[model samples]
Target chain A: MAHDRQPPPNPTSQSGLPLRAAYGIEDVPADHRASIGILPGEAPFHRGCFAQGYRTKPWRIFQLSGYGKPEDENERIKFLLKTGETGFLMEHDRSTADHLYNVDHPDVVARREDVGMTGAPMQSVRDTHLCLDGIPIETTYGHAGGAVVQHGPFALAAYWTVARRRGLDLASLPGTGQSDFFLTYLGCVTKQQVPTQAGLRLNADIIEFCGEHLPKWVPVSIAAYNGGDTGLNAYEELGALVANAIEYLDEIRRRGRMDITAAASRCGGVNFRTTMDIFEDAAKLRAARKMWHRLLTERYGVSDERALRLRIHVVTSGSKMTYQQPLNNIVRGTLMALTAVLGGAQSLGVSGYDEALSVPSEHAHQMSVRIQQILQHETNLAAVADPLGGSYYVESLTAELERRAWSFVDEVAAQGGFLATLDSGWLHARARANQIKEFADEQSGRRVVVGVTDFTDDVSPFVVDGFPGVNDAYDVALERLRAVRRERHEQGARKALVALEARCRGSANIMPAMMDALDQEVTLGEIGEVYRAVWGDWQTPELV
Target chain B: MTAGQRRILLVKTALDGHWRGLSVVAHALRDAGFHVIMGGMISGAEIVRAAVDEDVDLVGLNVGGHTLVVERVIGELRAARPQLPIFAGGVLPPSACRRLGELGVETYPPGSSLEAIVDAARRLTQVHAEPDAAPP
Candidate 1:
């Protein structure tokens, strides 16, 4: 099929944008031209964030690594760290962590084998402690796995509680929590969650709490990678991310607790997904920084440069890692990481080669880190920031993306903000539309995904059924749950539970009580019970 | 209608929310003129309930989890609606593919062409323009 399409005029352009043979600077819009001369580290940071680029600081080799039991996950984390992974991410199992449910929860009991298929199952503060065993949380940039909305408070509190148990000051903790609504509500919607309004309240509380304590923490990163993976194209991903930031900032402003600039700075450390459509995805990141600067300065009327500079973490698109010939995904990872660098990201995590089969194998995790290492050390690509900065195609695409994204942001605003759109299922519809279109393109051969739809032959010698993870995860989790209930101080647990319920009912930030609950040895399922009682379940919108 | 419209049952075997494959197939089957009922992440009992209640002409299963669970769903659906034709898709390895085929269900793993899927739908539903002839 690859040979059959030889003279097809490269069916799609390098940018995934339609192309003509050539063009002049005149074709660039007047609005675009005004910002043409803006350098990196300047206003409307369309070019890049740093003037020195990689020469000053290379992008961090931040890989997402976790699986099996807590100790097992910790061992894997330490292994990755030894492999020179600059930062570590704690991945919680979706069935337990994402929904804040314990393994004994009926929904989880139904899929026992899937308990730790995705990540480690942490059911209590003891499990959290086990996951953090031997890891230096005080220095390294840690991503405590709160990637879902409903689970954020529990996950963050558990990590902080572990830090406190280690005699580390809460004010000096240097980890970030990902209480991303996009992941929970949109991308991979769980069977249940707290209402969107309740989620907003929790996120705002996290932001406000982090502002006063844990000065080094990025409260909640708005990961557009979820949106993109769920099928939002480049422009839509950019638009929805900005819209999502607006929801956080607006909620904080309404609370009237923290400065809007501080909130903007905290929320500005966002994430995006980079695909093989290198130039377009790179332009998307470039456009992301510019759009963030404009949105903060114009909408919030804030002039703090720190608040305006958008810092991004890019995870190479996992969906783009084809399952056909698994080894090819390594090349795909490298290319996507290059696109991220071209777009000038602050940090990056390359998707594992065996992504379609399962989570990353230890070797696959090593390759992911090695991919970033090669790019940082050998490619000379990082020596200059936004190397595609002044190119007419790139600059033009970046400006066009910003224009389109802002319009999308406006559309979200008109619908009464991001949370409103999510509640109303309007955003899901948009993502569904892009998803359908992309599938149609691949189906009709207008776009070709090299290994799967085209280039069918494979020469690989090794078979990849992917990592099955440890079989003992379920057994260990059950034993731990019993141990916690059997061993812990029952009186303190009951008292903390009551306090948690009271805080949930009242207007106070739930984090302090949440920390207390963790310290008193409250389990995840118990906390989930309080959440369900107070907030109730969100009515999920059906896409069908 | 010229005759009774053909009804097809579509369901996901796992709670994983990746819906690109299901949505595309659903759209293509609908385009090819069949009533496609989506049973999202339902249990085996629920799958059987929908298959019987809808009186579906064909059943399509989207699987991303254990083959054992999918096998259970298939057995229940077959016991409930013995005459209904069945097909499966999504991340099915060669071993799983042969096993599902042994159960008398056609399998379309990733990279199955939409044209081929539409053809399978038409054949499974007996909706060809010339129904007197055998399927290709």
Candidate 2:
């Protein structure tokens, strides 16, 4: 029920690329170099990450699941796993985890009812344990919920400590902690947290700590999906993600801690977002791998083939889901999932049909999982590798995207770097410009957003209201925090906090102290206090 | 453009620090000749404090969390200034929008145009006509 309207004589993609009615061999640009002859899994691995693709290793069906009390999120995780999810991502409550405030903190206390609206409030190891109650972390891929930069060390340590207690080897454990800058600094800026320089230290520490141990863990995934959904167009998202990788590699190199090759491999597991711009978004994934290869080989002088291949996790853009006709988003999710499959994403999460309204209901989440299942099994998607490999239009778009992205990379470089752009509000300005333009396009009927703009004849009888969430989330979390504080051995917790504070102040890897702190049952707020004392707050630039 | 230049205070009810929506609304209001004060990720007390301190004509809220949180903020604002008009936009579900609407706060969910939001700001502010609010 969308996109059926006749074109406006001239149409452009979300990134402002002029559209055409038809294409041929000549449409593929003359200046565009040959990715045409390169095979999948080869150098400049934009075609596909693997030669046979889904035949060898199917893309991981990863979904972000959490809300309310620890047990509530735990039940949801178990349900997702039971219903054929390949990996689990634990989401920490934004109110508590994002700001590193326990439920009892004054700011959190001010808004008590909002505690678990975004995610489960996991304050200590016990809460994390309850969240992972029956999940087999040793065998399965786990996401320790540290999407915010400041909370990374605490979140990872809590998850790792739980694994160690279950007699799982840290070296063999497979998981990731998203110490992503784009999520906070660029996308969702926290109210008060460590400055970007300190956040870089936290991420670098995680990388070094994971390099020495936890070989299987993707230490800190740069989820550029945050940057993308925030308002970055396709090429800008690709360019900014590359610029972020450069920052990580440069820091690791400067420290002379781990081999840059190994660091590149660990940092390669990044993320991007797909929206309603189906073809452009699909081209984005293709452009991403090639850019990674170019960045590592041309810039970093890295040669290891294993380290060169970029493993991407694609999340369908959440902002694209409309509240006007919520059920239409199910179709939106499916099409975006299909785009990811076409683009050869290594992992994917389709935003729920009720995404604009609230966190996905049980049924909404199940539909998210089912969307991927149907794509993998019912369709013949898994039967081919690089199915769009030879399409003239796709290849032209791929090359066009790469060229435009490199220019954007240069644009970011002139702003100092990705992190500098973030700090200076340059990146936010770019995102804001694009956001205003896109909104204006929709407002002027230059863009038709299906049920939102043109086709508004939705007649679904289902009452698809947003998730109400558990009423007792705040009370239960408050009780849990009190219980942990009252029950944990105080002296040990104090010692660990002191040590963590020292590590934050000194030039030491903060992970060991963080792990010890978590093991000693130190709460999230204590760690927050230490970081606050050490780094102070990031003065967010004037956004309005 | 109106009886006088209107001032609006935009505050985020939750600590979820996404400024995209708030910034867009502020841009539109300012473009339409309203003085917009962006209160970044503040609580109800802080929001009320800003509204009263700034002596703004209208208060615009950006809700990223629960309806209850918005309700609490609405109560605080009402207590502080009875004549103050409040309008909200963000990730408000239909139910949350209805709940907030029942409290006399005009709710704009996702997909609501900037035109509608700016129009509401003008209308809500004009409804709150006080002799002191107009710039002499």
Candidate 3:
């Protein structure tokens, strides 16, 4: 009981906006001060998309490694790619990939010690080739762990059938899969899914099957960092991620089959979170690349300046980590990884100074990669690209957060858009009214969450005890699901589970019968029993 | 204080649904009046048949996995409600909150506090009166 730091008389921001002790160029709005003198790969790119940012690409140290057995998440993704981690994320096992269960699924054999404690119970394609064994995947950039939208066509057809059994070339594969509708229709709501209109027709059939054969795949990303860590407020996570990329570019232009500028450059590889509000989350990645170049040139006329440049990827928030001075969350993951590298993150992922308790104890994932390699080799912050570009309080909070995120994307297009405000829970009651006004501003000390509500004395005798992953990940995923149901080809895995239940009852693309039911080994609970017998779940709604 | 309404329940000892910390501790135990009951990711014989068919006087859980499946659902809800009273929260870890505080449960974890989880659900459902004398 010793709190007296005094700063909150009115300072607002984590989406309540208001803070201004000094900002002027007439508080930055006359047409965003003419795009603050343009340049950083121009065209409303909000001074980014790279004019030598991180001196031509440095921000990619992607993390989110996996947990227990698929060879213990392939030896913790080859120990985060030999402890530097410039891209690798596979984490699938939300009690069997968000309930596509197997590991003897009677609700995962009645919580068989919660199977690989949050990832690494791959299940088939020989446990995703023992979680991609020698991890080359044609020069790694992978993240094929279907961050759940009915486990994204079985984790991108088991990471493109282990990169077409290592000969590679599903049109030269790369990464990213998250079949996200804000991570299970609004950040972690999976009790069983497949119903935001069949997860928007399976993310418009994985953006028209990655515009015909994984064109360097990033197929379905749309993770507004799971709707701003499930309480959406950086202008409602940039107006529900531009109303979820206008429902995946109006269901790929009402199915004209590719070419809405290559499906807005494969929905411009998004993902945002960067939390410790450092200048409104570095002016929310410069107002999310000026609202993806004003939603692809004023609603889809697009004209491709690389499909209007919005390629962010930040992670940092994990509900702004603080479980009573856990090493003050490595200085809140180095000020949200230097606010995702001065808000121009091309890729990042800090969240884990034992993130509010568990997951990531390999020294809190090598201190989240030595806080991004000491902000990329001792802070010249990669010699600037949009280092708070023309700051009049970050261009008046990036033009008032793109004018209140285009009026919350016109109130999610008058509520019949972003999956009809996530099937009418109205964006989970606007992320439960910003998580009850951020837990009523940390229970009214006016949000002073330092060491959890103002320096609550820790005396750190250091104790983390988190990542307790492999306890024989459910008896070795029930002996590799009974040796892939007694070694494969059982009538070609029942004719690839009857052509993946006739392409989930005929629409067309269920990722080529989910890569022929993960190449006839068909197991993740028999493709979640043919998607719980053709999408008969998702009645979810009652969120709270 | 616990004459009429008390209830509680909760559930999710893991199949990982992530109901935002069980929907903010079931909206602070239904804003302190109690009667919660979510029970989402079930099974420990369906949480001892919903704690002897929802005659719950407290049972929380949540624990997104392994403290031996929340000590086998707190030994099947203390073998079907032996004076029921339990508490837990997600992503535990501080040695699984000292082995679920040596099995007498009460472990909130992740920066807990919806007024210390509704004052530990009004002292584990004895409902010691004043939340404007309950029943809102």
Candidate 4:
């Protein structure tokens, strides 16, 4: 199926650089002199997080694995773990999880088949328990799925409640809660969510709660991956992420609860996407650490090095993985993962080869891990961090990305900060514009995606229609929802719901009460009902 | 090239919020002298309401999730306004495309050309009649 198409005469990238014959010191720029000399452990960590690189600790092979019923998802997680995966990410069903709706919600019931297609249908603590069955939550690094803005507290509380039920201490848990605004507002706007302001408040509450109780937790990771996958380019992705961090940090400052350093540390565990634009995407990550260091030091006036050190988890771009000749996407996945590794990500999730077609098959997931393994072992690439550090094109691109991103950050700030832009649909417009440009570029043949825009035949016998997730997810979820309702202490559940409502109305942190709600077995939809009554829905901007 | 010249009704049959493909397609449609009314995460009833109220000649369904739900929307739209022409785009696989094609609804999956899409809009809306075809 491979077409031997000739490379274009002018193969220079968006940046006007000649296709090099591989030069050395002459390629290193003068202005970027200071940054080039800095080692991986030093300031402006463009090279990597630590000086020793993977020799100290190999990059965490973190695959985003979940789907179907809670028990099924749990089995998958254990499988990933057995395959040497370092972390577990619990993904909630988008229909229920993203909307904060339960299985019985009319909206969810309407598309019942779609339920748990993207993730496990975990609606309560019992479901969470079932999902975490036989897994040690205390030691293992985990991601409790709150991938939407509104569902953050419920997901975290549910996960924690299950841990608590297992006699694990909240203060000693090591995990993360992804109450990402980019996922909610930019990439996949939920049908109904609390307004951005309210969402921000909720994130702040989670941050404060995590800071006090779960010390080893990333409260809210501003997933620039969502923003990037939506349409934002490398620079825009960097800027928006920083601007998002500012929103959280500023909110913490206004609230005057925990130290700003502590909040920054909690917010520092961020995620970005690595696309097929290997050089630029790699530059984006290198530039990211520098920006984080600068933002914490120069802007916030924070001196804590730990707070300045940005921990990154990169998921290979799902959009880059094509639907056509799905097997070819393995090469795309390898290349994207290589970019992340070269960029020195602390953790990585290679989007499965069958990403465009469907959620990953078990084989696809293992292949994703294998790609990372091959890069880690077969190639001595991991030994040197930011190997492209001093090259004129890379350094210039890094600085240029940083400069442009700061401008975008200013634009975001001018629009009354990140949350405000989301509230007004301004950010969506920005992403939409870029998305249009991307499509137009492809249409004009300026962007050539092999096997898609050109060379569109597959000789391979293998055909991947996609792995259909468990069909029993809806039935199981419905049964579980009924079971939880039937079994839970009704009076306690009612009391918990009232307390949750009061907290929503009051100036109190919602997490403590949220945890209580989960303990009392107040269902996800009940909490959603309270949220609707108190904060009202976010007015989404018309992007499509 | 004036504003609100060619009317297009853009609706997502599924509640899935993966808006990247749809937004880009909608922009291209609008840029090609079309009025794009975003029917955000709408159901079949809402799609019918927008199509009837907006009086759009062409309906663009951004099918992010299952194609069956989209088929349901198409069925409802056909029942409400039999004359309306519909086209679909999103993460549809080849089989899904064939299914949509069987229903006379053109499918534009990922990697589809904006030019092709714009041309389809013109033909479906009867703004420009199909070449070599006699009037229906």
Q: TM-score of each candidate?
A: 0.94, 0.97, 0.37, 0.93
**Once superposed on the true structure, which residue ranges of model 2 sit more than 4 Å away at CA?**
A1-5, A30-33, B1-3, B130-136
- Candidate 4 clash pair list: none
Off by over 4 Å in 1: A6-16, B1-3, B75-86, B93-105, B124-136
DockQ for every model, please: 0.32, 0.77, 0.27, 0.55
- Give the C-alpha interface root-mean-square deviation per candidate: 2.2, 0.9, 9.0, 1.5
TM-score-superior candidate, 1 or 2: 2
Arrange candidates by lDDT, highest first: which order?
Answer: 2, 4, 1, 3
Residue-wise C-alpha lDDT for candidate 4, range B1-136, written one tens digit per residue: 3554778899776667888887778778877888888888777877888888887788998876666677888888888777788999886877788889999999887777888999999888874333322212
RMSD in Å for candidate 4, one decimal? 3.5
Ranking by DockQ: 2, 4, 1, 3
Candidate 2 residue-wise lDDT, B30-88, digit = tens: 88999888888888888888888888889888999888888999988887787899999
User: Could you give candidate 2's fraction of true interface contacts?
Assistant: 0.80
lDDT of 3 at A242: 84
Per-residue error for B30 in candidate 1, Å, reads 2.1
- Worst window of 10 by summed lDDT in candidate 3 chain A: A1-10
DockQ class, candidate 2: medium
Give a tens-digit lDDT track for model 1, residues A1-544: 6658543464444324666456568757788888888888888887887788878888888999888899989999999999998889999987788777888987677666667777889999999999999899988889999989889999999999999889999898887899998888888777778999999999999999999998889999999999988778788899999899888898899999999998899888999999878878998999999889888988899898988999899999988887789889999999999999999999999999988767899999999999999988898897776788778878777877877788888898899889888888898888877777787777777777888878888887988777767888888999999999999999999999999899889888988999999998999999999999999998888765
Q: What share of the true interface contacts does each candidate keep?
A: 0.20, 0.80, 0.74, 0.62
For candidate 3, give the DockQ: 0.27
